[model samples]
Target: MTISLHRSATVLFQGDSITEVGRLVEPDSPLGNGYARKAADRVRSARPDSGITFVNRGVGGDRIADLRARWREDALELRPDVVSVLIGVNDTWRRYCSGSVTSARAFEDDYRAILTQVRDELDAQLILIEPFLVPVRDEQWAWREDLDPRIQTVRRLSQEFGAALLAADGLLNQAARAAGGAEHIAGDGVHPTPLGHTLLAEAWAALAGL
Candidate 1:
């Protein structure tokens, strides 16, 4: 599907820390130093007079449930023309770190619910970024048992909603191998380093056909 971030479009980025990356929360705020800012920068460079607004509402440690809980205020109320999401890692992270397991079924259910709301209530366009993993350690590889299914869920939903799908998991791993190690991109197998963020931003732009 083609997603056009047309003139005067307000694109909202939603998800966990990966999207948030320390963005400020204030009037006339600047996007944080992460992929969201970088992606916006890429588009603005090509269309200087587009008058586009990019909003980042990524809260660190947020699971799908957390995002749905505040969806009305953070997402729906903004009335964005386009919405991009990079979530699900924290859902698996919490399982390993805090014993909070979010089954893939629950993840898909909550995700579809919000997407339905976005479509039915706002008729906004969607761009779904697949959650990725690059295991720095052998143990982190175990995360695949949890993350892979969710990645598939993202793909299915993207097709179901006719949204642009950024195949980030495969893209990042390919980059990591070329860069010599996963740590070079995502130091912790989760959050991205500067280069990793660049990859995500470029991938987002390219896949969204920006």
Candidate 2:
């Protein structure tokens, strides 16, 4: 059995495009085509009448530093009871393509700062989601070298912040392996297919015990 989280919680899902998934682009949209939508559905189905609210503040193509830029507007102001973050993929992708690299040290600093602000300023329960790439395409392989360390850093940060860790990267990797490879998830290794979103929802529900 999973640990029971607070009922009627206002959960905020934050991160890059993966988390954004066209949620706001569509009018009257409460969820998207990604894990945010899936996880919100699971929580609502399991805890109906709990009066829980799920907010999606994830923006497309965001990085750790970007999150910091919009923290006050996207996160702090939300006053979430539970905050879930799924970032770091864009950081990896940018660096892999000879793009400007945000050093692992810098990633840690920015990430830690964001979490600290949420913890100290908002007093929200944190959920750190480890971002993953399934190597669906040739370009994705290079991402592992740069991305792995950041994923580890996030995991450790999760512990440091007393946040629930959703090992989505590892879990998705395993799911990919079991499903015959990277194509099982994201065809491009960055975005998730419908199946990938399902796996993420399962992992989140199990972790949050919703």
Q: How well is each residue in 1-210 modelled by candidate 1, as lDDT tens digits?
A: 768877899999999989888775544545778899999999999889989999899988899999999999999999999999989999998888889999999999999999999999988889999999999989898899999999999999999998999999999999999999999999999999999999999988886586
Question: On residues 73-109, what C-alpha lDDT tens digit does candidate 2 reach at each position?
Answer: 9999988888899999899888867687989999999
lDDT minimum window of 10 residues, candidate 2: 1-10
Candidate 1 — what's its lDDT? 0.91
Cα lDDT for residue 64, model 1? 95
lDDT score at residue 145, model 1, on the 0-100 scale: 95
- In model 2, what lDDT does residue 197 have? 88
